[model samples]
Target: MGRGTAAGTVCFAVANQKGGVAKTTSSISLGVALSDLGYRVLLVDLDPQACMTFSLGLDPDQLERSVHDVLVGDAEAAEVVSATEDGPDLLPATIDLASAEALLLTRTGREYALRNALEDLLEQQAAAGTPYDFVILDCPPSLGVLTINGLTAAAEVIVPLQCETLSHRGVGQLLETIADVRKMTNRGLQVRGILPTMFDARTTHSRDVLDDVAMRYELPVLEPPIARSIRFAEAPAAGRSILRTARRTRGAQAYADHAKSLAGEREAAS
Candidate 1:
């Protein structure tokens, strides 16, 4: 494969079965930030809400094809993948994706649906010789069939954890679910790292949560948690990454640094 079709790509699904954790934002920003460092990336929106798609400036309602269609065998993955100006390419989603869980029930080997759909994309990359350095799949905040597909396809997992007691409580259970997925589906899957988000350094509670989480997780916590930023909240409205819409903002720098550091870690590991 020579790092093309067989050497294997870093398919990290940014997942956490919890909402409001910056999972989608981290997925989108990390894709672009990594792309900025000269790596080809593909961000797959597995969430039926399609927040990642809409955030990147695409109208999920108007799309002719979505990740759901690809999962249900209605269309090819290449048909729905669109280019982004910065670095990552997007395989958008629409609300119709919600039906995918029921729609694919009758299909054989249903859990492997997304992995199957990625075949053409992988082959194309192999032939073009521009193999993607990373493919970030943004999973919904649930352990449903859609997330199952992502678990089946990915080589690693990147979880965005909110620095709050309630959110932190879910991590142990989430890791157990990952273990479940590994036992039956993706043994290759590993937790690349846990990224702490929305942290306030001034607050004792936030700092305590950060330390608690780091002490608990086996994987090293990526340094520099993403600070609470309204600019990050606003970037999606402008249909761009924080790196573009809020380039000079601290939120943008934090995410950018996170991505760069992740790449460096992977390089060193290899």
Candidate 2:
């Protein structure tokens, strides 16, 4: 596979400035869903908390290498990638990543660190005849250097939001960051859509907030809101996505549908 043939790899940064918005959950679940569709996917844990790494059943404390190592050039991106039982590959994170922002601040072209690393890995994988189809980044809970690297690397952004006032507060700030990123770094970056996570259809307030957000931002709300489910919390303990831990549940089904919708959109765009 040549470099030109590797353009099919789509990178997504699942980002929101606010914590507990299901960024890691959506990243893992969506990667699993895409893998279920036979696409080779890689989930990159950009959060210093290593939530995505721990969520996939890996103990970050015990890892010899992580995304932090890759970012600091101590390791290649491929070296940090581990296979998950759920199907997609993961570039795990560790608490050591907390210092990555400060380290990157002194470096030139720091925002392209993730993009350059991922592109090199993708080229190698393409040469190996097993190219990844997608790369999903689980960004940190802040708009710091790590998240900026994520936004700069990704071609599109997926913001997972809880349907509530406090959760919605950061959307404007996130959009502003996206606007800045588009102007300053990744000119092709776009907000794919807003993903409503931990949504409860039974509550009228949830519905109202969702509608208001869509109207206010004039952004597409990705279909099939993920229903509030305890299974999301339970999956991490089991080292799998909700798709596997509770395959028949509403949340898993919604994510499966979302992945299929994303594939359809990609096809249409192509």
Which candidate's lDDT is highest?
Answer: 2
The digit string of per-residue lDDT tens for model 1 on 1-270 reads: 112236356677888999889889999988999998988889999999999999999999999899988998888888888997666999999999999999988888898999888867787877887767788899999988988888788877888888888667778888888999899977767887778898787789987877778787765677778888889888888889888888777767888898888688667655
**What TM-score does prediction 1 earn?**
0.93
Q: Please list all clashing residue pairs in model 2, or write none if there are none.
A: none
Instruction: Provide the clashing-pair count of each candidate structure.
Output: 0, 0
Residue range 1-270, candidate 2, lDDT tens digits: 111234577788999989998999999999999999998999999998898998898999999989988888889998889998899999999899999999989999998888889988988987888878888999999999999999998888998989986567878889999999999998888888889999999889887898898888878898889999988889888888889889999999999999998777666655
Superposed Cα RMSD, model 2: 2.0
| Whole-model Cα lDDT of every candidate shown, in order | 0.84, 0.88
> Over the full model, what C-alpha lDDT does candidate 1 score relative to the true structure?
0.84
Task: Quote the lDDT for 154 in model 1.
Answer: 84
> Per-candidate RMSD vs. true structure?
2.1, 2.0
TM-score of each: 0.93, 0.96
